[model samples]
Target: MYVFIVALLAFVLITPAHAQVHVDIGIHLPGPPQLVVVPEVRAVQYAPAAPANIFFYSGQYWAFANGGWHVSTGYNGPWIVVTPQVVPRPLLFVPVNYYRIPPG
Candidate 1:
């Protein structure tokens, strides 16, 4: 019985398990800033009350950060970005009033 158990253990160690598990977690983004555009700050027309350090508003793409609306020509971009960066990081995306424009 001891010999049988030892042999079984040896066989398990030597042979590769048929039931194998492998996992890959990844989201492939195109390499950094392939096409980089410096955006401009148009107006602080929304909820931030003050413009952001980075912002742009265009027909297709829109990114608001800092104090500007970065408008990209397309979804991926050839962005005409912009900003009015008085402060940093204080401006973040708000879910409740995303499209609500702030009054001066």
Candidate 2:
């Protein structure tokens, strides 16, 4: 009975940690992603909104909006914030364009 009680206590203590839900806060782009060409890098960037600096590169869509780096699988998204360290190397070099909203 003591062993069972200890196991039960352990389960109760550990269960909360496992039950935790990780929430990823991010922005959703309006409308479908449009293709944009970055001539300098010879890479195609997808702009979800014209004049808005959100882009899709490789497999993930990227957004330099809301003062942070955001990424998602689809154009319109439940985006998750990404640190500059994890941002793709190619995206780091994108020259400022008309769509890019400068981060203050």
Candidate 3:
């Protein structure tokens, strides 16, 4: 009984916990902004006139705001924060000048 309890406690202590956090970035766009294809990276398009650094690639909208990356299905977003790894490679390769609000 004692050995089983120790083994159970060890298992509990060694286990990892995973959690999902939902974040709202508060991005409001009046209408879809015109997207210009990135010259260097053809697959990625950017909104040169947007108030925020916005990109479109692979049928999803990506924005750089509030010191992180956010994504949505439409240009005007109920944005959700995502890790840097999940951002598409083409979008990530966009030139720094293309970003309306460049990251610090």
Candidate 4:
């Protein structure tokens, strides 16, 4: 019985917490920045002129800012923080030089 109770307590304590995290990347573009196709990764286009490391692929705008990845449907965004794993594979493979603000 004690073992069962300990197992139950462990299960309760270890239960994963899900929270919606909104990270304000603070990237406010006056207009859509010029997106140039990345030759190394054909499917992903990067904004070379934008102050932040920004990319466009699969109809979503992605930015690397505030030490994290954020995504939105438009250039000026209500950005949502996302894990690196969730970012598209092709976008992840973009060459270092393409990034306006390369991740350290």
Instruction: Arrange candidates, best TM-score first.
Output: 4, 3, 2, 1
Candidate 3 lDDT over 1-104, as tens digits, reads 99999999999888776434556666667899899999999999998888888899999999998999988888876677888998888887898999997789
Compared with the true structure, model 4 gives a TM-score of 0.78
Residues 35-95, candidate 2: write the lDDT tens digits.
7767765564756355556776787777777677877777766677767898888887877
* lDDT to native, each model: 0.37, 0.68, 0.85, 0.88
Question: TM-scores of all models?
Answer: 0.24, 0.65, 0.76, 0.78
RMSD of every candidate to native, in Å, equals 16.1, 5.0, 4.5, 4.5
Q: Which consecutive 10 residues in model 1 have the weakest lDDT in total?
A: 20-29
User: In terms of lDDT, which candidate is strongest?
Assistant: 4
Count steric clashes of candidate 3. 0
Task: Report the CA-based lDDT of candidate 2 relative to the real structure.
Answer: 0.68
Decreasing lDDT order of the candidates: 4, 3, 2, 1
After TM-score superposition, the amount by which residue 70's alpha carbon in candidate 2 deviates from its true location, in angstroms, is 0.5
True-structure Cα RMSD, model 4: 4.5
**Judged by lDDT against the true structure, how good is candidate 1?**
0.37
Whole-model alpha-carbon lDDT for candidate 4: 0.88
Model 3 residue 21 lDDT score: 50
